[model samples]
Every structure is written in C-alpha cells, then in structure tokens.
Target: MSIQIGQALPDLDVDVVEDGAPARRMSTASLLGQGRVVLFAVPGAFTPTCSDHHLPGYVQHFEAFRELGVGVVGMAVNDVYVMQAWAAVQQVPPGMKLLADGNGGFARALGLEFDGTAYGMGLRARRFALYAEDGVVRQLHVEAPGEFRVSTAEAVLQALKAPEAGTTG
Candidate 1:
C-alpha cells in the first residue's frame, strides 16, 4: 500500500538550495515540525508539465497556501544543482522551498517513487501533493501516470477545506 494520511512522515534527509547557493540539509521531521507544510513531488525538474503547469501553479498560488497557514516545498528526484537551476529558470517565488531528493531517498521513504526508465526519465518520483500539519499528513493527492488532474495548487487548497482537513484517514 501507499503512504497513508495521519501518519507522521518518515524521517528522511533531503538537500535544498537556499539563497542562490547549494546549502542546507533537512529532514522530513524538521520541515514538518517547523509548521504546517505542503510537500509536493514531481517526476523531474524542468519537465514539460512540471515547468509549464504543475510547479508554476504552485508558485502562482503560493500565497493562498500561506494564508491557510501552510509552508510549501517542491521535491524532485534530481540533485540540488538541477533543482536550483530549474527554480532560477522558472523564477520560483520565495514562498516555496525547492528540495532535491537525490538518489530517490525521500520518495522511496514515502513509497512514492516510480520507474520511468522506459520513458528515459529513469527512476523518479510521481506527481503528488501532500498536506501536513505539524508533522502529520492531512491530505495526499497522487496523480495518474500521465495525468495532472490532482496535486495542483487548487486541489491542495481545496483539500485543506475538506471535512477531514489534515488527517490521513
């Protein structure tokens, strides 16, 4: 089975590019403990849908996420350098943290990695958005293989308003 809601995220270390330099190592626990957070994963950095629609949507609606008292992070199965370059290329806003899940560590911990070698993407993460409050998952939206239906900013915002709210039930 996949990762479930309400469970505390697995403790995992991931690298991030902060302030235009490659620095800082964080764990899932540290990030979630800091505040309510949205952890969204993409197949790869700078992919078509990711660049054109998915991630940009998150950047575009980041404030709405903040107003709901949520910190946002974007993760991909790429190195910190690539993630940083992609962020700069796309002009990512300040509200979201861009994370590099090098070696697919974080995604595997969450049971979210996918084998994309057939498509030349190699082993990577799926497109998914997770809503967590104080270290516990509240909502999770994972997309179909080639679909971008859910896991968008709008979906995550709407998920926050659901009756279940932040529980992983």
Candidate 2:
C-alpha cells in the first residue's frame, strides 16, 4: 500500500543535486524530517508534462510555498546528473531541491512505482505530491494515469490553506 496520512516518510537515502553536481547524500528523514514540506514526484525528468507544466508550476510558486514555511522539493527516478541538468535548465530556485532517485528505490518504497517498459522508459515514479509536517504525511495526491489535476501546485496550495485539509486524493 502507498504511504498514508500520519505515517512518517521512509528514511531512505536520496541524492540532492545542485549546481550540476551531486551536493550530498542524505536520508529522507533528515532532509524532510524537521519541517513542513511539499514533495512532488515526476514520472521522469525532461518528459513532456513534467518539463512543461509540473516543474514550472512549482518553480513559479516556489516563493509562495516558502512564504508558508514549507520547503518545496522535486524528485524523479533519474540519476543525479540528469536531475542537475534539469534543475539548471529550469532555473530552479536556490531553496528548492531536486532529488535523484536513480534506482527507483524511493518510489518503490512508497508503493508509487510504475512500470513504463511499454513506453520504453523502464521503471518510474507516478505523478504525485505529498504534504508532510515534521516527517509525517498530512496529505497525498497521486494523479490518475495520464491525467493531471489534483497534484498541481495550485491544488496543493489550496489544500494547505483550507481549514480542514487532511484528506488525501
């Protein structure tokens, strides 16, 4: 089963890419364990929807998330190098992080991995987003296959602003 509200995120190692380099390897617990965070995952970096909409939406609203005291992170099953290049091309803001989950380990751990062999893309993450506070999940939005709506930055932001926003989608 997929991770649910009130469960702590899995403490797996993920590489944080910065300035076209692998900055560090840290456990998810350390990276997202202390504060409010919005972690969004793409099927693959540089893919159509991810490049055109998903990533840009977060980039555009990076400041808004920060203003709410929530750190924004983008993750993909690609390696650190690909993640670095994508980050550079997208002009991702300094505070935001791009994670390299090269082996799809993290996605699998969350029960969010999808086989894309038919598409020639191998194993990849599903399009999803989660809101966590001090390591425990508060909300999760996993998009339906080939669809995008609930996981958008706007949707997450709206949920965050709601008085009772614990529901998952």
Candidate 3:
C-alpha cells in the first residue's frame, strides 16, 4: 500500500540542500513541519523526465505556490551530491529545495519505493507530488511507473486554487 492523502509524512532524516550548496542531514519532520508544504519526488536524478520537466515545473511555479502559502521541496532516491548537481544545473532558487533519500528510507516508509533493477537503478522513488498542511498530507499524486500526470506542478496549482473553505491555518 502507498501513502494516502491523510497520512503523516514519515519521520526520517534525509539530505537537504537549503542554499544552493551541498546537501546536509535534516529531519523529515523539520522539513514538512513548516506550515503548508509541497513535496515532489522523482524516480531518479539527471534522468530525461526528471531533468527536463519534473523539477523545472516546480522551479517555475514556486512563486505561485508561495502565493498559496506553501513551501516547496523536491526529492529523489539518489544521494545528496546528485541533487546538488541537478539544482545547480537547473538554477533552482532558494524558494524550492531538493532533498536526497539516499537509502530510500523515507520512500520505503511511505510504501513508495520502486525496484528499478532493469534500469540499473536499485531502489527508487515513484514519481509523485503531495501537499501537506502542517505534517499531514492533504493531497497525494502518485504517478504510474513510466508516466506523469497528477504529479505535475500544474495539478498542484489547480488544487491550491480552490482549497477547502473554513480551513484555518
């Protein structure tokens, strides 16, 4: 079973890049505990889809997310070094962060880890995007193994456009 919309994000320590530098250890709770948050995970780093589209979408729409009062973070099953390289290559701003799930602990805890031995990547995260209020997921978009749909930034934007009424911060 995969992580559902109402689930609290797993508490684990993962690598985080906060200032366009190399990633350092950070608690997942600390990462998601700051108000509203949008977290997108890719299957791998430097891959075609992840490189060309997945991450860039989040990067470009960052301000729009902020307007909705959400902090954005990106993750993948790779290590911190690759995340740093990808961020630098894509010119990702500070508003959006990239994290490394080095051993796939977070992904495994969420039941979102994938076996990609055929592709030479061992365990990896499925393509997904989620919105969390505080630390509980309000929306989760898990994609098909080789497809992208509900996980795109556009989908997130649309979701944030009409949040529930009477929901307090």
Candidate 4:
C-alpha cells in the first residue's frame, strides 16, 4: 500500500527546520514539488545507524546531489527540535533540508509507518529513499527490516545515474 512510481506525493503538513530553528509547516507536495528531489527518511533522529551512517552519507554526497540539480531532504518522525539538533550535529549542508514528521502523519499517508513500540520507539518511519521529479515518484528504495542497503546515498545516486533506472521497491 505504500506510494509508488507515477503517484504524486501525498499532501501532508510537516514541520521544517531552517537556520537552526523551526521555520514553518510545509505540505509534502510543495516540499518535493517543482523539481527533482531525493527524500530519505529514518526511523529516528540521533539513532545509532541514522547518525553514524545514513545521514552522514547524505551529508557527504550532498554536493553531488546538488550537482545533479536534485534537492536532498532528510526526514524523521521526531519533532522539529530533535531534527534541528541532529542537523546541527551532522552539519547538514545549506541546500539539504531536514523535516520533522511529528506524529508520523506523512509516513502513515505513504503507508510507510511501522510500529516500533516493540523497541520502545513508538510509531516511526521506515528507512527508505525516493527520487521524484515534478512531484511524481520516479524511483523508490525501501530498506528491509533491520537492514540498510538500497536506501543509502550511493545506491540512490547510482540509480539516478543509470540509464534504465525506474521504479523500484
């Protein structure tokens, strides 16, 4: 039931952080609309894998994404404050955005929310990344439970660069 290729992103309001503060609430359509975008979501901010590898990969390859005229965004179910702190700690680049999907509304809308209550983490977004152009998904890479591979920055970059790249699960 998750979103798929050729589907426009669902319109859901989520918090945005800019300049080390909560900037404003923005709908998913407006945030990922208008151009090429790469949006990657993590289960939580400051979590081990998220902080150590997932987010850092994006930060390191941010310029490469920008070079391709693709906007990179990081998202998590945590609040804006935690996102801001994570951004600060990760030293997120200027053109990259970090979103606070508080309440997991956006993730639920995408059918990508998972029950992390077993881990005492509550509702959270699955680790995944998608490439979209003009609001329609072109490629989607969703990681398996307790795994991280297809959603990494390098994987997405390779997909984007591939001539035959298309919708993927």
Candidate 5:
C-alpha cells in the first residue's frame, strides 16, 4: 500500500552520504528517528527543475528548517556515487542530507515510483516531499504529475510553524 499521513515509514535501507564519513547504508527509521525530518524526492538528480529550483529552494532554506528542529533529506533514485557528485555540484548546505535509492526500492515501497522509460530513465521517483517525526508521516505533499508546489522547503517551514504542528508529535 502507498504510504499515508499518520503511517509509519517503511524501514527501507537507503544509502546515505554524510560529511566527514564514508557512505553508509542505513534504514529510514533510524534516520528519521533522530528527529523530525523533511524528506524530498526528485525525479532525477541533475534535471532542470531539480537543479535550478528544487534543490536551490531547499539550500536557501536549510538553516530555517534546522532552526525549526527539522532535518532535511533530499532523496533520489540515483546511485550513491552520483548523489555525492550532484551534492558537490549543487554545493548542498550543511543542514541537508542526500540519500540514494538507486534501485527504486524506497520509492516503490512508498508507491511513488513511476516509469521513466519514455524519458530514457528506467524508473524514477515522482516529485514529492514529506514530513516525518520518528518515522511517522505527519504532513505529506505529493506533487501532481509534473507540478511543483507544496513540496518546497518554504512550504514545509510554513507547515511546521502552524498552530497544530505541535500536536503532530
């Protein structure tokens, strides 16, 4: 089944690249367990939308997300090495994390995987962003096909500052 708000995130093993550490493979649960997290998925690592606006939005708002006690993770279906290179190219800020779901297992498990065969990319994750606290989704924003709204860090920050956001815990 597709992951839903109030549902616990699957314990999927995703490859993460952290600063000052070797590439480590870990479960989503463990990563989210650290604190509230804002996880965003893109269709591809270095696509136009992803490069010009998507990642830059998050990069611009990383400190705001951190100030609100939220960890940011940018996930894609690319390999770990590619993710690392993209991060370096994008100059991802300190507060955000990058994860590689190379095989699309993570996206598939979330029911968010879509065929990118037509675009010459095998399987790509749909553009979406989710908020999880201790691995349970609190507020999720899944973009409509080829749309980009409500998934940006700015939106997540606004949601996090809402009156009822406290009860999400």
Candidate 6:
C-alpha cells in the first residue's frame, strides 16, 4: 500500500553522499527530526525525466525552498555512486542532498517501490514529494506515471506558504 498522509515516516536507512566522494548511512529520524524537510523521490538517478527536469527543478529552487525553512533532498533508488555522478553532471546546487536509496530499502519501507524490470531498470521508486516535520508526514504529492506536476519546487513553495500548512519544528 502507498504511504498515507499524516503517518509518521517509516524507518528508512539510506546512503547519503558526503563531501564529494564518501557515502554513509542516514536514518529517517536524523534527516527529518530537526526541521521541516522536503524529500522528493524519482524513479532513477540518470533517467531522462529525472536528469533533465525532475532533479534540476529541485536544485534550481533550492534557495527558495530553504528560504521557506525547508531542507530539500533528492531521493532515488540508484546506488550512491550513480547518485553522486548524476548530481555532479547536473551541477548540483550547494546545500541540496542527493541521497541514494541503494537497494530501494527506504523506498520499499515507504511502500513506494515498483518493479521496472520490464524496462530493464530493476527496482525503482515512484515519483513523489513528501513534506515532513519531526518525522511526521505533513503533506504528500505523488505524481501519476509520466506526470510531473505536484512535486515541482514551485508547487512545494506554494504549499509551504499555505496558511494552514506546515509542521512545527
């Protein structure tokens, strides 16, 4: 089942690229516990939509997301090495974390995993963006296949400004 809105995030242990070359495990609690955060998931690290638009949209709006008091992160089912390479190739923005779900461990935990073997891509994450505060899901925007509307940086920024939205940090 898909993760429901208002549920606390599942236990997710993902690998994150640190500095420029090294990677380390990061827990969901550690990443989302201290503040409002935006975690956007893509199918793969270097796929056309992901590389051309999905990831870049977040990177380009990193400053704006931060200005609204949100920590922005990109999550994919790719390994850390591929994630890091894709980030570099895209000219990753400073302060944005490009996190790898590795074996889709985190994505599976969140019930967001999908088999892409028909396309020969193996396991992958569904496209979605989640907003959390203190680890509880505050808002979730999931996209239909081949659609890219709700997870854009602009949409997230507008949501953050919603009078009735946001989680107390």
Which 10 consecutive positions of candidate 6 have the poorest summed lDDT? Answer: 160-169
lDDT by residue (66-139, candidate 6, tens digit) is 88888988899998889889888888777788788889888888887889999998999988888888788888
For 18-113, candidate 1 gives per-residue lDDT tens digits of: 556664798778866656898899999988998999889988898988888888889999998898899898777775688899899888888989
TM-score per model over all chains: 0.92, 0.96, 0.93, 0.96, 0.92, 0.91
Q: Model 1: number of clashes? A: 3
Q: Which stretches of candidate 2 lie over 4 Å from their true place?
A: 19-21
Instruction: List, residue by residue over 8-124, the lDDT tens digit for candidate 2.
Output: 899999999755555689999988899999999999999999999999999999999999999998999999888988999999988899989999999999998999999999999
lDDT scores in order: 0.83, 0.90, 0.84, 0.90, 0.84, 0.82
Candidate 2 lDDT (Cα, 0 to 1): 0.90
C-alpha root-mean-square deviation, each candidate: 2.1, 1.3, 3.6, 1.1, 2.9, 3.2
2 versus 3: better lDDT goes to: 2
How well does candidate 2 match the true structure, expressed as C-alpha RMSD? 1.3
lDDT of 5 by residue, 1-169 (tens): 5688888888878999767356799998888765789989999999999988998899899898888888999999999998988888888876568989999999998888899999899999888888888888888778888888778777778878882542221
Give the deviation of candidate 1 from the true structure as CA RMSD.
Answer: 2.1
Q: Return whichever of 2 and 5 wins on TM-score.
A: 2
Error of 2 at 77 (Å): 0.4
Q: Where does model 6 exceed 4 Å of error?
A: 18-21, 163-169
Question: How far is 3's C-alpha from truth in model 2 (Å)?
Answer: 0.5
Looking at model 3, report the run of 10 residues with the lowest lDDT sum. 160-169
- lDDT accuracy of residue 95 in candidate 6: 73
Estimate, for each residue in 1-169, the C-alpha lDDT of model 4 and write its tens digit.
9999889999988888766655689888889887999999999999999999999999999999999999999999999888989999999988689989989999999888899999999999999999999999889899889999889999999999992676555
* Candidate that beats the other on TM-score, 1 or 4, i.e. the better one: 4
Where does candidate 4 stray beyond 4 Å?
none
For model 1 the local lDDT of residue 66 reads: 84
